[model samples]
Target: MSYVVTVERVEEQPAAVVHGRVDVDDLPEFLGRAFGDVLRTLATQHLHPVGPPFGRYQVDGDVFEVEAGFPCDGVPTPVGDVEPCTLPGGEVATTLHTGDYQRIGAAYQAVAEWMGEHHWQIAAAPWESYVDDPTVLEPRTIVRFPARRAS
Candidate 1:
């Protein structure tokens, strides 16, 4: 899998989010619950997702702190574990990854290498946009990192 990382500007997006701290091996189940709850909250509040589901992750030891949700048309009323948040607007280093999620680390590595070669620094936490359905034979995800000049 080869990635062509590029820099582009993104607009801030309102979202209904659910944050969780779970074992790395349990992330998928956690994301399922989070996304489902967020969707339910959106429906109840009459807010709609503007784009695909997205998640931001940070790993520590064997656990991951994940913030998962959807880029929605409007901020949702906080309900259950869902709360309103914004996907920050700024220039980003991004690339699309096509393959199994198990090998997605390669895509992140590609973005890091590309950024190092271009002298860019990640200025905020990175995220993944779940762009394709799970049933798709080749699932695609967009990986992005908010960025700034190295110095």
Candidate 2:
């Protein structure tokens, strides 16, 4: 349960998301295919691993966000390539997870439970910050869920 503090801005993003119900059991295969698809499309565009994508945030059902990034300077490799958009920075609740994307759900559950205890309302969608090369590392991601103390 390692965690780090960070500040990120959410920019105007139109990246294509692999929308589906992804459980711990389905991560590896899904990530492999998703990254591969994103990379293949973005040939000249280098796919940077911001962090491992795991965990679940219930915006409308449990939505799971995954890794890989396409910065503003980075050319749009795929049709759905998302540029670094505007992200509102403030006090955020975050946690880090190392290895096995399947176990990410527990991390999300942990954060949600922690929020409950602290009386915080989830303000936005949960996002995973990739910290390594998905093509290289075993996989490590920072799960951040925006929150505000409940009134």
Candidate 3:
């Protein structure tokens, strides 16, 4: 599928994040537990998604950390005992990807290729936003990377 590539200035987002390197294969299951179940449970209590779940962060040591489940409109409770925090905003190179986790690298590579072709440099770690819940469907996710406007 084709992705509508563009740059967006995201505001500071309040969310809860987990930091750890999981098996690439378990990324989906992990996300469901970390995001879907968390959000679904929150929504039931009237907590709705304020923004998208951003993740797939790869640090220098290959640390795959994720900050997901944004603040909702309802009262924050101890449903799953997960607290919320804010995620700072910046310009990002966002795109969507289909299929399984293995193919994700290709999608990321595609983004890098695009950036190179356009003379844009990535300014921060890449992040993935869980658009579709992997618990019910294939591993479809949107990849976003913070970047500065190339001169």
TM-score of each: 0.95, 0.55, 0.67
lDDT of each: 0.91, 0.54, 0.65
**Candidate 3, residues 1-151: lDDT per residue as tens digits?**
4555666777655555444466655666666677766576666666677756766455444445555455454445655545555554787777888776566777788778777777778987777765665554675687877777688
Q: lDDT ranking from best to worst?
A: 1, 3, 2
Which residue window of length 10 is worst by lDDT in model 2? 49-58
Q: Which residue pairs in model 3 clash with each other? A: 15-85, 55-128
Order of all candidates by TM-score, from best down to worst?
Answer: 1, 3, 2
- Candidate 1's TM-score reads 0.95
Q: Residue by residue across 1-151, what tens digits does model 1's lDDT show?
A: 8899999999999998999899978888898899999989999888898999999989888888899999899878888799999998999999999978888889989998899999999889999999997678899999999999998
- The model with the greatest TM-score is 1
lDDT tens readout by residue for model 2, 1-120 = 544434334443323233344654566676666655554554545544332333233343454344433323333533653323323355567877777656767777777787777788
Give the number of the best model, judged by lDDT: 1
Of the two candidates 2 and 3, the one with more favorable TM-score, higher being better, is: 3
Worst lDDT window (10 residues) for model 1?
71-80
